[model samples]
Target: MASRRRSLATYAVATLVLPLALAACGQGGDEVDVDVTGTAPATPAGSSPASPSAGGSSGPGAPPSGRTELPTSKRPTVVGTVVTGLEAPWGLDFLPDGDAIVTERDTTRVLRVTADGEVTELGTIDAAAPEGEAGLLGVAVSPGFADDGLVYLYVSTAEDNRVVRAELRGDRLGATEDVLTGIPNGFIHDGGRMVFGPDGHLYVSTGETGEPERAQDREDLGGKILRITTDGDPAPGNPFDSPVWSWGHRNVQGLAFDGEGRLWASEFGDSTWDELNLIEAGANYGWPEVEGRDEGTIEGGPSGDYVDPQAQWRTDEASPSGLAYADGHLYLAALRGERLWRVPVGPDGAGEPEEFLVGDHGRMRTVAFAPDGRLWLTTSNRDGRGTPAEGDDRILVLKP
Candidate 1:
């Protein structure tokens, strides 16, 4: 457990135990003040992106309900280019044979890319409604992919954000079926990221759809980390008896399990700070009520129990999106920061975070560990927020 330095002491448990009074609220206006530890490494000359003005949410989050001993780790470096010429590529996963299944956000196109750099269009999800930041987002290959041939997706529709699954046939996807539905939706803050945990349950991340109040509403699906079975039922032992595994998240976009099966998420913070949290079952991550660290600051003051992030950064330094754990470190892909952040994790919790590939790859969106132990990193230069370089959207393979 890394030390948490806050301006205020921890709140009493009695106040936090009361039923939350849900009310629509605007974004917090107070300046966020929290003790920031460690320093970001400098980027290469002439490679840095313009410093971003504040306004975003979440970077990464914590692990699931489980814990285990840490394993040996390794550092990763770019090894090769897997493919290029993509359009706002977001979700990425690999097939049993090592073929990559990718999703393009705006195009709603699902693609299969071979290791040799051969790209093939698998199909498109017509139901996906691509807007400011929502569309066909995260993709997860079934844990039983070799046998079930199923792939799951988190998609934004005109009505709501939902999870759907389809069979992966040769070179194409079969008819899609609803796995879960009725999540809130918005033009921005549509948290969409999915990964299967070692417990064989599906973990889904959702945003508050810009409704700060919704994040605190236990009945709402938005702004929550959900644990469900492949069929979308609430996973056994869930604290809320619903899909929610954790709550009060602004917008969680990245999730990865470490060697110990503990889950970590990268989140986007609003204006003040971006966060990397170790998720735990039923934990509450303060949203409108608090931003980065709950210094007992904020206008109304911190009234509820909220989990402090294991690590945090300025929004300009880490509007982090994708996250992956490899070689005993958590790799975070920063969008506004234009860098990859490596945070060392050990028995005492997260260590000092270091920056890498700063501005080297403009606006990284996703980073995932491959079957062969290499990492697949995707650039989000074409995501409408970033200035695209030549090959705007592409994938880079890295060795750890």
Candidate 2:
């Protein structure tokens, strides 16, 4: 397992220039310029654009009454910000003892946040991450926390971005150990997110390591999601016994599961489309070959197929980040898009996804479903994007 992961260090070094080489995406546009494949992502025929809000900003907009629609299609209200002043916060996990673990990109540190909004520095990793788009990113609570008090983190290190495990010691994380290393790193494509699925397996999302072409390669770890155990071996019954669950993604930063156990992923597209994907094991998603739901054949993929995107939008509308599901819907944080989007889900995994909140916050990052069923969100203006409203980086609770 280590050997396979180690193989990526070379690729990480070789393909580390993709973000600069790729064309600028979305550059303030309403329509996503379809990729070379030639077809735009399909939406319901009657789909109309959302209205602009009180603020100058607009897109898939926030509710007119200063509210949001619940997962049940009801209106939603603000529940107040939980924590504030997080610098480029990306992922979070609630602890067993009424606390939460948070990741910071620039600091390369994990923070433990208390209920009263106090944040204590946990510890730092030796992540050799590149600036502009990489650093400490994802955190996951151990399924055996009671016995081992372990927490897992995915980091973008300068040497290589990888996953590491640390023992949780009250407010500090102790004794960090590398679990999976050398997963391809770069300024933009070093994907840093991980989660423990219900099946007791660890799932990880990786980027194309700055190389768009790598996304289409099944033999490469870049642009793939992997399922592994605590020790970083591929989960059982993987396609071809590879650690990958799904492949051919540009950069997947957000992942969530609905009540029916369907996994949804959020992807960052180049120049045009931003994607929301319904994920299944052994599935292929078109990336470099196809950007969104474009009309054309995608070549050089597993089974040589072109997979369609579930939902897509111009990057101005939804450059989606972390994802969460509640009230029978999925809520995704839009980064470059600066909004929160709600997608209604049906019993059989089909539903129309529409943008719900825009301009309420700036550069939304992560959306989490708390244990008590409250919907929580975080903003990322501090990492540099929109106008930061004094202390704009905040964790907000959505009134259910």
Candidate 3:
């Protein structure tokens, strides 16, 4: 595994220059070459469009959410173009047949975009409470999907944030089953990203819900990395004998495992710093007490008790969301930074992170590895915090 990771790193470095060349040639105006130093337009407040819900009403007895419409923009130049016309698309997972499933944050819609760019609405999540940063967030296909046809979703409901399982009945979604519940929910900081780990257990990242104290509370589910079985029970061999795998996280949105089965996570910091951590069992990451590193000890904790972050960036430069590990590198999607970052990994640890596509795509979000070895990235410009260009929110396929 170590040798393979090193080889993949070589391939990634050798082909890294292709994107610059493609940007210069301007392939049919599909890609843009923008000045990284230029100022971006002021972002409009609440710019995401309210997609029509499938269950007649948008939420439980609530009125249809207001939609914010913007003019479409030209698609950016990338190695591959799979599909277009995704509204606030967040999570992405590909099926065995090469078709991909995507989740729209505000719309609560789960769409299946085929390999040929044909999009079919699989279903809409009726329980999704679309507000601020909470809604239908992450989607993952079950490893047994070929037989059980179950797809998992992480969403925020009116009362709290939870995880549910929905069966795929033909083209539409079947009945829903609640797997986990009682995660703290708020207008902001509802950490909602889940992935099945290499161990076949579901790993969930939750936020402190604007309450920094919850990060240190081991009993609370908020602001921690949770490890559970598919049945939502705490997985065996857990450090705390509970779902809490690690505590003291602010808002973790990105989770990925390296080739060696080591877990890496991306977290959004308060105002000073954003962090990338190597998650471990029963570990405490200083949150309210420490932001990036422990400059000094604080009350209720000692500095040596907490583990420092593996990598950190200023909050203005990196509000990282989704993370993907491929070609011996971890690709982190930065929201406020408006760029994609590549961090090379080896047996020693992660090296310095390098920026890519700086200011080219607005508010990049999720990064996922497709089955065909291409890296799929989503734009979050239409999420109310970014200046949306034409075709503002799009999925760009890159060869990395």
Candidate 4:
């Protein structure tokens, strides 16, 4: 735990020098064409590697591919210029005007980045406590932002991990109000990812706070995906009649819904596996009791009682964080694997994942789609585990 703690702390402090390093590389915008070849280090045993598959097929129960059109058999290329000088940038959400709001995990600083690469400090979360992975993590622009101008954040406070909503008053965030509270918080496992589902409800992912038991405890708020309204009340028709939607997760930082409205989450594993699970309502994902797809371990929930991950990787290959669904694929940003993974999805299931930008940009954290049909990826090189480049912690724009 101490080593892990140090890693997280180092990542935070390393960002302090990011501005200086980025300035030497030409400050704001620098163009570099990235090779999107699906080649990285060989997949370690027990994890699936990326594969090419038919692109337009629909997954089971998936709706017709209307606006979710995917690129067919084409490799993505870097858009040449990157948005630089971010400090441990964690979450990204685009505004109606094509501007983006980015969160700095350690500093609790929220920045407004224009489509043209202009950066401005929007505001900071005063109560955010940065320890290990606990800090201001995720940000989401209100679905109704055109009218209400509200922004939501998932932050780690001194007392607990919570979600708060604020208004964008001019250039800074206005007074904040808590939307959800009482989620368990610790130095290491404060799961922090928030997104408004297509169903018009807010879905929050939480970690087990380094306490494995909480993952299985249906009564606990940690280690589960919670669904609620904008005002923090449980969403109507929740499976448990509480905020808890699904249970038995260790640390889930990535959440995305496909064209089919199926929820997929990325989970961090103990030492063996990292999982990309197809989440179902009220289903239990074996966490303390199971690691990956049942390696015959007795520690998981009883057989036939828990759900298995649709895809898994050795922890070394994928400690996935933020997730985005675009063009019929799920893009996962790997922290330890230091690459962008693209998994093709259809109504059947997930195809083999392909790795991109491997070792080109160190420790990718978040993958989000822009309004212009491009993929915006953030690096975590300044986040302790990676060797910082000239413009460390940059946002790379990729064209699919």
Tens digits of per-residue lDDT, candidate 2, 321-399, equal: 7888776877777777766667666544435554545666777778887776666777777664555665656677664
| Ranking, TM-score, top scorer first | 1, 4, 2, 3
> Which is better, 3 or 4, measured by TM-score?
4
User: Candidate 1, residues 156-270: lDDT per residue as tens digits?
Assistant: 8999999999998898899899999998998888888899988898999898888889888888999988889999999988888999888878888888887666677878888
lDDT of 3 by residue, 1-400 (tens): 0000111122211111000000000001122322111111122232222221111111112332343332322111255445555567788888877778899888788988765566788999999988878888888888888998999999889999998999987789987899999989887777777777877888888888889899988999998888889999999888788999888888887888888777788888777667777776777777777776554445557323666666666665568888889768888887887677677777655666656666777787788888877678888776767666765567777655
Instruction: List TM-scores for all candidates, in order.
Output: 0.81, 0.80, 0.80, 0.81
Which residue pairs in candidate 3 have backbone atoms (N, alpha carbon, C) closer than 3 angstroms, thus clashing? Answer: 30-76, 30-77, 31-77, 50-67, 72-390, 72-391, 73-390, 73-391
Query: Alpha-carbon error at 142 in model 2, in Å?
Result: 1.0
Order of quality (lDDT): 1, 4, 3, 2
The best candidate in terms of lDDT: 1
Native-to-model Cα distance after best TM-score fit, residue 367 in candidate 1, in Å? 0.3
Model 2 misplacement above 4 A: 1-73, 128-130, 296-302
- Lowest summed-lDDT stretch of 10 residues in model 1? 13-22
Cα error of candidate 2 at position 348, Å: 3.5
Error of 2 at 109 (Å): 2.4
lDDT of 4 by residue, 1-400 (tens): 0000000111111100000000001011123323211111122222212232222212222322322323433655565444776667888999999888999887788988765667788889998988777888999899999999999999899999999999998798998899999999987777888888877888888888889899888889998888889999989877788998878788887888877677788877777667777766666776677666653334324324666666666666668887889868888887886667778777666776666565667777888888987877888776645667765667877665
